[model samples]
Target chain A: MPAINLLDKFSRFSDQWSPKVIAELNGQAVKLAKVQGTFVWHDHAEEDELFFVVRGTLLIDFEDRETVRLEPGELYVVPRGVRHCPRTEGEEEVWLMLLEPISTKHTGEVEDARTVRTYDRL
Target chain B: MPAINLLDKFSRFSDQWSPKVIAELNGQAVKLAKVQGTFVWHDHAEEDELFFVVRGTLLIDFEDRETVRLEPGELYVVPRGVRHCPRTEGEEEVWLMLLEPISTKHTGEVEDARTVRTYDRL
Candidate 1:
């Protein structure tokens, strides 16, 4: 397969909150998503989720701790079973690259309307 | 843990070919490496490695396939058991982010002088 260019991938879709799978290795899926507004407060029971900001600002609000803010080129790993919510501030949309086990549900068990079980491969 | 800035992490080290463990999750390791010259031809028997170019150019030469060239913001996955060698072209050094199983050996089965059995956490 040819190299996957993140900028080119981001140009292919405009949907918000729906992650597009770009690659998978070792049972983990590498995804890209455009997120705006606030996301549901949930956690993967057995999978740690990695959020890497590609553009804009991402603020991850936690239930028991301080909210973590991520800027471009920065990444944060939310441990499994930690309740948290992610949102963008000021920016119209936030571009994010996520790394998580394939078994991880987008919204965990919350069943939010924005939850996407099977991501479309980009 | 605080947000990890890839650029900041890259600034913290300048060693060539030595990968530094930045973050880990789901039994996988997220590492950064600055590579120059050609790496030894080797393959992980049971682990796929994802290489993302952070800066400069990266070229991956495979045993039975065309070489893949990667630029910044581009990524390629070297499948498990595929003999491949990575090298930099033109540029003095290439910065890369790697994702692979935590048990993966630095040089796979090869015992090269540049092989690092233990990676330092940055």
Candidate 2:
């Protein structure tokens, strides 16, 4: 497999809230997504999700009213079964690298219009 | 859990080839290491390893004589049970983020003076 360049992959798509799989290792899929506005509250039943900020800032709001803010070159992991919503604060688009199990659903247990069941492999 | 800043974590250590765990997600450990020079060739029997270059460049050499060169913002995964060695060229030190199983041994099946059985959590 060739080396995956994060920025080059991000330049391929412009859709928001849609994840594109870049690589798979140890049963986990490494995905990149361009996100803006707010996402729905959802939780994966048995998979932990890692969010690594590649560009811009990201705010993750939990059901308990706790918020985790991530900047570029930072990462945060949301444990399984924790309901959270991810969104950007301003007009800037956020570039995120997500790591989760291959079996993980795009929107976890909650499916809405923003749900992307099939992800394109970049 | 607090968001982990890659640069801040990297600033806390200067040891080469020693991995410092920063986060644990889904039974997998996220580690950071500053590496220079050559490392022993080893392979993990039951775990795949991911190498993400945070700064500088990295070269991964496989037993089959294949080499993968990674630059900043690039990532490569070495499949399980593949004999490989990681090294950096020139005088610059490479910053790397490694993802592997929690139970994975640093040196794999080979134990030598450079082996690190216990990694400090940053």
DockQ (0 to 1) for model 2: 0.88
Estimated TM-score for each candidate: 0.98, 0.97
Q: Compared with the true structure, what per-residue lDDT tens digits does model 1 show for residues B16-96?
A: 999999999999999999999998999999999999999999999998999999999999999999999999976579999
lDDT against the true structure, per candidate, is 0.95, 0.94
DockQ for every prediction shown: 0.92, 0.88
**Candidate 1 residue runs with Cα over 4 Å from true position:** none
Positional deviation of A98 in candidate 1, in angstroms?
Answer: 0.5
Evaluated against the true structure, the overall lDDT of model 2 is: 0.94
Per-residue lDDT tens digits for candidate 1, residues A28-82, read 9999999999999998899999999999999999989999999999999999999
Pull out the clashing pairs in model 2. Answer: none
Best by DockQ: 1
Q: In model 2, what lDDT does residue A56 have? A: 96
Model 2 chain B TM at 0.97
lDDT of 2 at A22: 94
